[model samples]
Target: MRLSTDSPSINDSKSSNKHNANELAPRPTSIKDTGIQESVLLELMLKHLLSGGVLTKAQLVNKMGITGGIIQELFDKAKGLAWVENRQSSAEGHMRFALSEAGDRYAKQASMKSGYRGLVPVPLAQYSKICRLQSSRRNPITFEMLQNGLKALVLPNDLLHKIGPALNSSRPVLIYGPPGTGKSYLCRNLNATLGDSVLIPYAIAIGTEVIQVYDPQLHHAVDNNNESAQLDLVQGHDPRWIECKRPLRITGGELTAEMLEVQFDSHSRTYMAPIQLKANNGILLLDDLGRQRISAKQLFNRWIIPMEERRDFLSMQSGEHFEIPFELILLFSTNLNPNELVDDAFLRRLGYKIHFDALDEPLYRKIWFQVCEEQGLSCSEEMFQHLVNDYHHLLEKPLIPCYPRDLLGIMGDQISFMELKPVVTKALIAEAWSIYFVQA
Candidate 1:
């Protein structure tokens, strides 16, 4: 069945899929580390060496069929990734760089992993190859980039910092907390921290002449004709790929095997890459891991192969299978037991599974103030004590007034309607509680 272009949605719901279940079963470690570019570069060097250990600089250039600058760049890179030794020939007194044993072994392993049977012949048309190679290694999000990409509310600094590094540097992170505790907020902000370069806000395809935004939901022209059609068209995107930047994408509960699989677009006549596929080189935060209609165990099961191999399988509607860069910081946020969500077997494979317990009292206090200042309310010690003693302590709430602030927000709005003073009183607080809090 066909799915929506922006997110995965089916016109029919006959075929269902499992999402999250049995946390402790230890998910099959869908922890595929992205190292495609490195493998390619290593193979390039290996081919250069397999022919002969002693090629002159000119021969090396001609063999790889690349320019001098490219050769030197590859040479320098080889020196770092592969072991090389220099020897002076007694006959000609020229330096020859040859792969060390470790380098040879590494090259072979890299070649095998990349599905390269032998060496790829150097061709000028290989430019697309380089771009695709870069796609996997590319950084999809960055720190400053995050600041510009969000419309959702930002969570506390502590929460952001606690889970931020794991988004890129660590493995799949599990963010667990009760509902309305800002779990989704953290996921939304992930787009902001993605590297700006991968954001590709806009692009004018060399073939089409039409300017297209890097926006995945919109851009579909992949050929010269489409580009040409789009070129004369108005609605030229701003901050084009060269300028526009949005790398991270958040998916709450729309993840599916089909989303993980490939779909051929009859309209576009091309394969519509899945969300995670597009998330390559960026963060793909799976918000509400356990709340999906799909079963947790089944979702974990689908991801098992990808986690272990750091690569995933995608099948066309015609049943043709292919692989793509699963290079993304996959984050799973849940309030349910991590063990209950997945089997222990599945959980162990996850790179880093961190459970975010309830926020402590002091942190709760700090966040409450943040809510006050942003909402423009004058909160005094008397007011604060009244809250802790009269309401917060009595209700045994999470202390930060996550819901309390929401209620107060309503009161603040009423203030605008009634023209009351900004300094909120117990009456205002009571009004907020009535509107926001769910009484037992």
Candidate 2:
């Protein structure tokens, strides 16, 4: 089922309204509107000048992601303080500015305080407001949407119904089942069902401390080279806020308790937002749930408040506590028994606990044929019957969704290495199966 490119329906008016509300962060006209102290802005400008060496007004504007007026205002302030001097005019009649000795000293001092010289950060209050607004306006996921998004997978309709409601509820979901039953795969593709975008700031400011929020590796920027984006720019859209697809972060066995806290880099002298913070207004999948370095109970305790209250409290290096909106879909997928991981009380708190069991014969065969088609290999009915009756049934191995794709992959690799024709034979299937599973 292909995603419909049709326009949104009338029922999505609330989502449309919220989208409009968060579509753009209005450009700040003055230092007051920037939600940053003038001294801080000046120090940042000085640092930029010291690093970049002789910057034009337009260049500073581009570098700082602010308007030319603000840059000129800072330049005037810096000139008055003897921290900046205007150089001779260029061929384009634009006066270049460089930091004087005193300005250089001030910049070095500022760098000692904090090395953040990137885009001006959004105020923490404003960032929290936008996160809550976007989360509140998420469009309700319909069955049609879920079906279309997951059409490639061989999932049962009953499971889809459960998943659709769980996704719309904006609560924690526990997907537990046997290994390789497509649990993680389903969670990964859930982002495709959103089909919506959110505004992500480059960084956020709390007091004098700066915490970078946008990660180029995690946040994929949406193409904004269209008419609407042009209109937004003309209408004073904030360049510091990037339009991006709803983020999807997945962490498996590598997860640690330290990762849940705000991280500080001594070299950069700036705080890095945690995974949950970056995954706001999107999805965060804790795959391989019980396999983390942290115990299940300890992990549950860490998330207890965030899961129930829908807000997370994080701490800074200076013992300051702040709250951030926990506006994301939390998904936990595990191969272990759910009861073994957490207690009944904890399970009761989850919105939905859906089990992903082994596939029945018909579904398994469908996936097998689908894999065969994808691998460009022909599987005759006789071969298929031989695989099912002799390999799986005789050995009492359950039909798993990943088996077809993985076994075929192994067979394809063997064929390529041996310089044999690309065909699915009983011998090839037997060899792949033997190599795939250990016989007791």
Best by TM-score: 2
Q: What are the Cα lDDT values of the candidates?
A: 0.51, 0.84
TM-score, candidate 1, is 0.56
Residue pairs with backbone atoms closer than 3 Å in model 2 (clashes): none
Expressed as tens digits, the lDDT of each residue in 1-440 for candidate 2 is 11233446544733553346335467777778888878888888998998999888877777677777788889889999999988888899978899899999999999989888888888999899878767723567788878877787899888998999999785799999999999999999998778676778889988888899999998987644122322112453576777777899999999999999999998888889999999998899999999999988999899998999889999999989999999999999999999999899899888799999888888999999999999988888889889989988988888989999999999999999998888899889988998999877
Error of 1 at 65 (Å): 25
Against the hidden reference, what TM-scores do the models get? Answer: 0.56, 0.93
How many clashes does the backbone of model 1 have? 51
- What is the model-wide C-alpha lDDT for candidate 2? 0.84
- By summed lDDT, which 10 consecutive residues of candidate 1 come out lowest? 17-26
Name the best candidate (by lDDT).
Answer: 2
Candidate 1 residue-wise lDDT, 1-440, digit = tens: 11111223332211211110111111111111111244354465564675467555445544432333444556677777656655565356645667778877875555443322221222212212322433422433333334444424444455544554565453566777677676666676654444232322222111111112134453322221112212111222211112213346676676665665554444433344566655555566777787675677887888887666657666555455555445556778887788888888888878776655456666666666777888888878788678777887887766532654676688789899889888878888888777777776
- Where does model 1 exceed 4 Å of error? 1-165, 168-170, 199-214, 218-246, 265-270
Question: lDDT score, residue 256, model 2?
Answer: 95
For candidate 2, the 10 contiguous residues with the lowest summed lDDT are 224-233
